[model samples]
Target: MDLPRAFTIRESSHRVCNPFTTEKLALLGRAISPSPGTRMLDLACGKGEMLCTWARDHGVSGTGVDISTVFLSAARARAAELGVADRIGFVHGGAAGYVADDPVGIAACVGATWIGSGMPGTVELLRRSLAPGGMMLVGEPYWRREPPDQATVEACHAERKDDFLPLPELLRRFGELGCDVVEMVLADQDSWDRYVAAQWLNIRRWLDANPDDELAAEMRAELAASPVKYATYEREYLGWGVFVLMNH
Candidate 1:
């Protein structure tokens, strides 16, 4: 099993594969300050950036699971590049029902919470692999401002007004799930740009190389419309963060 071709193509150049920039990611890592030798389990760990980096910076060890072979390959290369190959392992598999064999110091599902259906289920899934008092990291998006209309909501890539909560409500949801909001690092507009804008270039380069590809026209349309759509709707309306939670 693998990720859709469109996803891999759009984010082919991305290391983190989310709205988080390297700085924001590092900030989150430091905020948690995982002790050396801590064990982590990262689900839907795109390109394994967090795992590889933490293994390098904090001397932690982890396993990352993802459905994309392409991303898994990139993840392994990243582990080798950071000289942390021995500290991390990657598996090519679905993350929806996957749990670590051992209770971990940290369990994370970043950006891809749909793997467990939604926030509550995702938290439960992470908890299955979390040791007592260990941290659970969830990366998610919130509405920065309420969308004015259905068109705006659609533009922001939400099916309805409730697709994402505003920041305060998001935190409250964590409380509702019986977790304390321990720490967080948010994505700024610039970081959002780095994540979204870069996709256009990747799509453009791919279109140039594969003009006859079946998805080329679709990608071209997306490339043409994405910048304006992003600047108008997503950049201003969406806020993303990696939040650290501990069970209460």
Candidate 2:
């Protein structure tokens, strides 16, 4: 019904929750250049930034589903702020296995691909809601470089080295899924900093206001440890991007 308190606290200030800045997001939207009136389905659509912005810039209509009521509220407000409220809908529910009533011009499972277990399953789930010839957008992380050790892998927030593929192999994965790699907008180190570094501020602010909260200690420890961890491992080893794919 709602996201974990930790997640909500960490991302409370984020409009787009992945390692993408506003420029990269705009670049991705323009690259795809969804035709006016195109329909989109975005699963686990954090704060509905993609759909709302597309509705404003490209005139696309869409539905965004997420389990977090907090994010859904932010999404609705964003739609209104962007004056695209009529063009998009926000649903507070689990995104896993959810499909649109009709095939859409774009179907996406960004960042939260765990909804379908992994990349392949998430791609299949998106395909179920995509119209013929429509594109699918997947936001995923890849290994920027092979980690030198298990400690590095763990520092990068991966359980194992295989948790993410190198960039070339990741593209090959789309091919394996029977999709063409049509377009992609990748996150640079600065973008990753924007995504990860901003969380510290949000968590710090939350801690200041709610010192007695049960999660405060955890947030403080994360705030203390995250910067070193990110700069050391994730910034160098992990890369994230939103890839556009088409059925082959």
Report the lDDT tens digits of candidate 1 across residue range 1-248.
99889999999999889999988889888888999999999999989999999999999999999999999999999999999999899999999999999999999999989999888899999999999999999998899998899988888777898989999999999999999999988999999999999999999999999999999989999999999999999999989899999999
Residue-level lDDT of model 2, residues 1-248, one tens digit each, is 78888998999999999999888889999999999999999999999999999999999998999999899999999999999999899888999999999999999988988899888999999999999999999999999988999999888777889988999999998999999999999999999999999999999999999999999888999999999988999999999999999999
TM-score of 1: 0.98
How displaced is residue 175 in candidate 2, in Å?
0.5
Worst 10 residues of 2 by lDDT: 154-163
lDDT for 227 (candidate 2): 95
- Cα displacement (angstroms), candidate 1, residue 145, comes to 0.3
